[model samples]
Target: MPYPFRLNAVASLFVAIAPGAFAAEPDQIPQDMNVVIVSGSRVEHTSFDFPAAIDVVDASRIQDSQMRVNVSEALSAVPGLVAQNRQNYAQDLQISSRGFGARSAFGVRGIRLISDGVPATMPDGQGQPSAFNLDMAERIEVLRGPFSALYGNHSGGVIQLFTRDGQGRPTLEVNTAAGSDGQRKLDVNAQGSSAGIGYVLDVSRFETDGYRDHSAATRDQGFVKLTTAPTAGGKLTFTANSLEQDGTQDPLGTTWATYQANPRANEIDSTDTQSPKRTIADRYNTRKDISHKQAGLAYDQQFGDDRLHVMVYGGNRQVKQFQAFSKFLQVSPSQSGGVIDFDRDFYGADINYAFVRPLGDGKLTTTVGLEYGHSTDDRSGYENFIGNTFGQEGALRRDEQDKLKTMDPYAQAEWQVGQWVLTGGVRRTKLTVGVNDAFLSNGNDSGGVSFSHTTPVLGALYKINPLLNVYASAARGFETPTLNELFYSGSGAGFNFGLRAAESTHLEVGVKAIVMTNTRVNAALFQVRTSDELVVDTAIGGRTSYKNASATLRQGGELSVDTKLGAGFSGRVAVTVLRAVYDEAFGKVTTGSRLPGVPNANAFAEVAWKDKSERIGAALEAIASSNVYADDANADIPAPGYAILNARFNARQTWQGWNFKEFVRINNLLGRQYVGSVIVGDANKRYYEGAPGRNWMAGIGANYAF
Candidate 1:
């Protein structure tokens, strides 16, 4: 994801500028407030330096919200993006920007996700980065479009997460929360520093009976970070974060007939949860379990006017799943003891360097970095009840695993003039892929390798004033074919290494304005052109092959207004509009076909009031959206549009009016019906009917501090 461009022309034209002699006065930074920024982009520093889009959400926005899970959940209210919960109790979700709403194979679409300045994506460029602790995060910065060259490949927009750190005296915190649908959450976080060493440890265990049948999910997450500053010249940081999850298996997308037969149960909802007769007649229950671990180390050094940073990180994940009843409809039923196991591991290193030099007129900043990593997978599919015992076709030994390794090198530079900011970056990539298929007659494994073009971007930021900024930029991004996409030839002609990489070009323009001392407005418009975009061929049904489309275009804009209401009452509102199209005459698709899965718009608004004296707080919010389609053809089968409203009220108090505090919260103030996921395959293959209707609960919680 290196962003390279023709900066010589811009630098040539920007030479005639003033010296240390500048015009603007000191930045009117909010005295006590913090500005969480997406690192790499100067957009966080000033709006005028880049003609692109960048968003910063402060800590207050998070603490007052009712979101659980990951950053996407917390950002569900943000404009320009859509967050969808699959409701399987797996911390399952889908978040997309521009025109990529329903494309949830792995996770977010064309968006680069980062945590604590480290890359949070799979080597194949497709996979969900597990949600770290949202409560411990200080702020989140989101940059939209291809111009986000600072971080390489999958260079779609970028999200940078920053965790809270030691501010002063050492402290310890403990909290617990529980609500309806058998929900409960317990958290403990502590921070302290001694002997030039600082540390933060956050741990949480959360569980829920779920809003629906077969929807139960539970997870335990913990992270410990240690930072040491040996001398005024150097700092070292070591971090270890781990997560364990187990619950109901994957939810099967069902049809209206299946739903009408049993509205409360899932395609695999367990009858065991009920009575003998009830379980004997019901066949809608299913279940799944998974675990993941991650750890890393980083170092930073400061030498006078420059700073140096280097980091190496990696992780491993495993999943165990079971499904039934569906076997009655598919190739075979996973009845009895039918189950599957999947395990994966990844470890890589990110090395980078940055320096600043003073020139005659102004200053020049340059950066170059190289990233190399290896990711491997060993999967064995075993059916506890394989063979005729379960009336299934696959054997007990049926299983598959894939191994892949990739190397990428990237570089970038930023030049500052009187009032203009110019920048560029680029990266080259090479990959090798191998697959182990139990059913294949070829060999134990099959392999293929290839090299690809670099992802690149260029941008400019123009600061009109201390409170006004405008920017624009263009970037090129590419994603290599994944293992399944390259070698897993399914029922039809399985794998095709012949498939090309998914590529994209993003163009953007936007402005940031501080309306007043207490309010701010940020907005941006973007259009992305993508070629060889991966799309499943449904015409043949179950047969998978990728076709390189001529080119698909997606355009959209986002607007957000944040205001400090003063007192303890504050609010914010945001809206987004997106459109996608692909005018290609291929397969069943004729010319002028709109892209499928992408939504037209997403909107959210919230209001909250807090009273420490009264020991009370309440918040009300709404998330609404338009319809979605199964295909660009816009046919009869479609996902309808829906809206949801949520309200929360919490009261806090002290025991002796000092030592400890307790609080209670009421969630799901209004219950509503909806659908969260729509997968491809069978005509009836659909995950339907969201959280059950009309259920409420209240829980008393306490927090201890030392």
Candidate 2:
């Protein structure tokens, strides 16, 4: 179907459902409106009254019948966000919000990631979601649109995970799961509160033989948390986490011909004369090893009608990756080689004070905050072959010391009175990046660049009635080039300081309503106009370069409806329609060309049933997305549009201080074949990454309390 038709169809479906849903009696408004969120304002407030696009995935939805290994599993129902597992653990998850981070070749960019009040993103705005410990997550709050600008640079959107605090009786739990393709997981956790102090600890390991050729991985994670009231009216929290993955194989993307021939086949290394059928991944032993550890402390104090909050965190990460670049590619002196090694240390702190007072006929709350972050990296690159032995580190090609520092000061206020709620905020951010070239054999390439921006946001919401709210918001935001993006120019030169930051203007209008007495609906229309938009210029052999393009425009609408069907049944639907394209021609990319990697439309729907005791449940889910382009010119075979079905069943039982739970799930129930994701602008046309056809997983858990 045409993109416009797909969008209209989704919109019409919502329109058809709204009238009947809103006909319920006014007195039947659900109490779910009381759910509090803190992502938009830095203070607790109901999402219904917050004038921005935000969604919350509670613990039940995050953990039930799931492997809990990747956040992508739980985020499909969130409109305006795309999270793809890639099925390649070596590169980590790919996440983009509203087309902001769609061009990312790896990891997460253009978005902010926070956990337990500490930033998971680095000072340069690159984040690794693999660091998150989902076993302890209580809820994940996703904030989009104008309000995200308040978080400073590269804040296209924000996703924050809050862990559950230990309380009640002490308990210990163990879980084990196994599935197709040799996938398996084991997890153990303990939590309790003693003498006014709370503690939680978790450890888990996951392994998979992978559905695609030459893709295999193993990961181990650990988390610890402690909470206590150290003084009257004051509470302190401490958290620590670690993640380790060694020798995770990377199944590089395949050419369209190869994918069509065999979705599970690897890209053959045509240059290998001795073994013609040997795949590039097998020939080069493409893989990555990562080790990461972090710790954070947060303290909050209440004084009458005011509050003080402070957070400090520090971490270190080490990574070694081997890429599948051919030997010929390294003949150029400017080439950074095929082996990447980096060790980084990072630390940051945030301090804020909130004051509350009465103004006119309303109550006003204001917060002033300061944030500082720093990171230093010892980086080096090496050739991937030594004496014809591929995959072994050869001669060193480049070495550098890279440092990033950021400081931001921001303030925001919220006032609520009668039927009106008003909010405004501003942030001034300064970022400095410096690189010192240690190996000058390829020529001295060292420099420093700094960027500064002041962003402001404003929003207003009006309560149309006890069951409905309408809101509008606007803001200015900016995204600076990440270290990876700046590492190489289009010509393969080192560190392109000429790259400019992308600045944007955002506008949004939305509605929040309770319908059918037991249903909640959120709908939004948004637009973003950006100058100096960052785009992929070239990609070859696992190395990608970025360049700033002409102005771009993104206009979209999002709708999410969640309702109770009674009889212990529920249903949910989330739809997104986005039109992202270049507004002006630039470098062969004509005006109106759709942005690569972003689909024109996507949707998710689910129907679930549970026993009255909530001990047995099942759900049927459908996920669909329109086709997406692979290049700036829209000149390649696009990943075809696809829809898939999934089903899951879970059961629970409790007996004398013990709890037992088990679940079984089947994905891609129809055994459809499709590409799950793409590597945009791949110069070699190896753009498609195939998803699994059909898969099953079963798990069981046992908990004991004392």
Error of 1 at 427 (Å): 2.1
**Cα-lDDT of candidate 1:** 0.61
Off by over 4 Å in 2: 1-28, 330-336
| lDDT of the candidates, in the order given | 0.61, 0.91
Model 2 agreement with the true structure over 668-693: per-residue lDDT tens digits: 99999999999999898999999999
lDDT of 1 by residue, 173-269 (tens): 7666666678788777788776677888888888887765657778888987888886698888887788788754344455545554654555433
Candidate 2, number of clashes? 0
> What local lDDT score does residue 614 receive in model 1, on the 0 to 100 scale?
44
At residue 247, candidate 2 shows an lDDT of 96
